[model samples]
Target: MDAHLRELRYFVAAAEESTVTAAAARLFVSQPALSKQLRALERRLGFDLFDRGPRGLALTSQGSALLPVAREVLALWDRGYAEARAAAHPHQLVVGMQTAVGRDLQRPAVERFRARFPSWTVSLRLVGWDDPTAGLADGTSDVAFVWLPTAADLATRVLISEPRWVALPTAHPLADRAEIPFELLLDEPFVALPSAAGPLRDFWLAVADRPRPPVIAAEATAADEVLELVTAGVGIALLAEGNTDLYQRPGLTCRPVPNLPPAQLAVACRPDEPRKEVHHFITCVQP
Candidate 1:
């Protein structure tokens, strides 16, 4: 019986970490979940992968033998997947974005890209905020329009740098102001991005600008959800200035926060990306 790629991945992680707890942490899954997958893989192979111990797990002889093979298989699969994407979709460049890049950037850039590569096409994928890289990490996007401070492995060029603004319900007292002081809104409950968003979440929460941690009213995974939450009076949220016009609704009001550092929107791609078309798209988006 053939083991699944996911099972092999789990096995490799478990073998390397030497403990289900460590493996789960490394994989961003629960211990029980990782343990269950490992047991399932063992059952499929009709052998135990690890010998349980009080201190930690020890790989069985079979497990140790299989570890390197599994690692090689996973590496080969990654290479094959990347190759397939390039070969199968050479003319289509996928651009992932978390929100509407409404600074009149998308249209002109895509037009320029199309003009440059007459045979090529662009696919704009709207990804959620949970993936701050906008699908670059997983190879779903050839290039992404992502907020600044993304993964270090990816390269970025800042296309838009604008002041961060606050979104509030129309009825909120702060909504009436033309501009709100950063400190004045510091105490209000804030709608935050998912913790999976990492540094991007902290940026939106103004974590560095605050005296203490923000009081998170709720977590939102998308720009629309954040706007909806603010409109429903769940909590206020911070946004890039370019998004204000795109997300504007009757019940939501946006006010600039002059003291806060501006949010930067960039075109990001894997630094090692082989496709010249991807780099061309980045150049098209550059200010």
Candidate 2:
């Protein structure tokens, strides 16, 4: 059974990444090699683990049942490993996030964090937007910063709550307006977050039961992509206030939308796993 630990690691990576090529890149192995290992693992277990579809990998029943058990085993192993190495080396903190944190917020925060924990190193991982928790629930990040309305299971700390705005092409009729009401933008098509973002997606769409309905022109998981689509006339979207600074392009214009409820930016972590390191980092970023 111990021999399968490596297989478990491979399986978990493949499952989390949802594609052989992506999992291989993360694991630092060739794509073909990763595919072979996955196939072998399936044969050894005598069942299919993933359903390869147009939408990418979806776990089979057996895979879903085995996932939590495998995570438990990995967590136990990691704890033991950390204990064994704590005396010999400095600790490392891995932070996961979906959006661009920007130099204004991250620079001072990281410098202060390093000064506070002089011996520790930090790794900022850009997790995809598919999981609203931004890797916190999966244990990939010690802590994560993401838009609010994440999974209820994870703990959260609100960093910033700002009014929403709309981004559209300069060619848009309302581009010259100083401020636009939320009602006016509802009937227009807009770029939206992927469905996997859960409530975060719904919140950004501002889908109230008004007569107007959301016409999603395209789905985007990153800010730059959404902005690009916006400028290309794909659609307009409601954006957080901070996005005005994060995305500044010649073809785009951002205007405050006075009526929509604001979005909150927050730091999230698993409630079951809290540490001083995470607490300190939170302090450094707090407004």
Candidate 3:
């Protein structure tokens, strides 16, 4: 077998990042060098690893299958390498959330994590992109608040499920209507998230039943960008009911939609590499 751990590491990084450039940046290597090594690995393995798209790279079925094994090997290696440091150094737990979760579930959870692990550093990170785990696959974050159907195969726990709502221009015709119907907003232009956002972008675009491709007037990676686009009449956006207050912007108004399932928020981590700190934080969440 020509299998090399270095090749596995590079392949996993490229797969998770879904782009050679991103993987290179994360791995601290030149893009061409990363590409060269990836091609060599593919040649050695005798299978294609990624499908290069205009937006970025996407994992092939074979690539997806290899990802978990690669992760397990890396985690085992980390455990062995970290054993000495873990004993002498203060343990630190990094947690990531898609948004600033300020509800009762999150507040007490933080407090409890701090009280329980006084010697450990607990850091809460607000993540903006669809990959809210912020490299959790590579062991960067111990836990993350992410949307369901994220990455297709990560282990997750649902935190909140709230109905989806639309943010429209204040002067929109449907502004007077208390609740806008999905049919009414079908033809309207929408602000879309980056393609890398995966299922999350599709959810926000209401892509399930549209007859024609949605008109993407702008691309937003954060809540503020969504509101800015909506206020400027560039496009409308869909969000969870709880986020209506958060994305509130001048000249933009949020209204309920008649029919659509609410977005589901989740806390996710690698299934195989369970950590004590991750459980402590998740257990603290009341609901």
Candidate 4:
């Protein structure tokens, strides 16, 4: 039986953390899901990986011996995958984004990038809000347009800073206001981002400014769903001002939240990224 990379990763995480709960958090997966994968891996290998006790998990003799080998395999695979992607897609750059980067940034930046690197092609990948790094953490994106308060390990530069705004159904009483005070909307049911989004979700919900947790009408993993829910009067959502213009629709209206701090849009890449193309793309997006 062959051990898949994902299984190895699960095993490695479990071994290092010595607790399934901690390992699950580190891997951004549910504890039960991680436990299931670890069990499946043990079944395939026909050996016990860990000695589960009340205190926590301890690696078995077989697991201890396999740990180093698994780490090495993962490291080698990551390096090889990067090298192969560069070789096969030498002229392409993948940019991951969660929402429409409207403020006239994306088109102009892409144009500038094309002019600078005439032989290169750009691929825009729309990632769900659940992955706050916008695919950067998974190595699927060469660069990303992400909201502020992202993972600390990634390098980021602010591209735009704008006031936070609220998206409400047109029929809502507050929709007619020129601008709504943050305090006025405190008790309203709000559309929230998935819990997987971590602090990014808190930022959108204005958790810091709230007296208590805002009522969650529903959760959405994408900007479109948030807007759709708002249109249906399911809940209101907080968004950046630029998005107000970009996502304007007949049944939806957006207004500024004067008391809230501004939101920032930034270009992020792995801090140690070696690719010159990634840096070049960052340059193109600079205001």
lDDT of each: 0.86, 0.79, 0.76, 0.88
What's each prediction's TM-score? 0.78, 0.70, 0.73, 0.79
lDDT of 3: 0.76
Where model 2 places Cα greater than 4 Å from the true spot, the runs are 1-90, 209-212
lDDT winner among the candidates?
A: 4
Clashes of each: 0, 0, 2, 0
Candidate 1, residues 1-287, lDDT tens digits: the string is 89898898888878766878767754668999988888888988999989999978898899889998998898667656766887898899889999988777888889999999999988999999877888876678888989987644688888878999999999999888999999998889999987567678889999999998899999888999999999999999999887888988989999999889899998998877888888988888747
- Model 1, runs deviating above 4 Å: 1-80
| TM accuracy, model 4 | 0.79
| Residue 4 lDDT, candidate 2, scale 0-100 | 77
- Of candidate 4, the 10-residue stretch with the lowest lDDT total is 75-84
Write candidate 4's Cα lDDT for 1-287 as tens digits. 78899989889878877889767865779999999999888888999999999987999999999999998898677656755786789988899999999777888889989998999999999999878988776677888999988744689999888999999999999988999999999999999987667688899999999989899999898999999999999999999998888898889999999979899999998787888878988998857
Comparing 1 with 3 on TM-score, the higher-scoring candidate is 1
Q: What lDDT would candidate 1 get against the real structure?
A: 0.86
Query: Per-residue CA lDDT of candidate 2, range 1-287, in tens?
Result: 24377788888877877987666755667888988988888887888989988776789999999888887787677555544443344377778888887636666877999999988988898876666777665566777888888644777888888999999999999999999987778689989887567678878888863466689899887778888999999999888888798888999999998867888988777676646877788778855
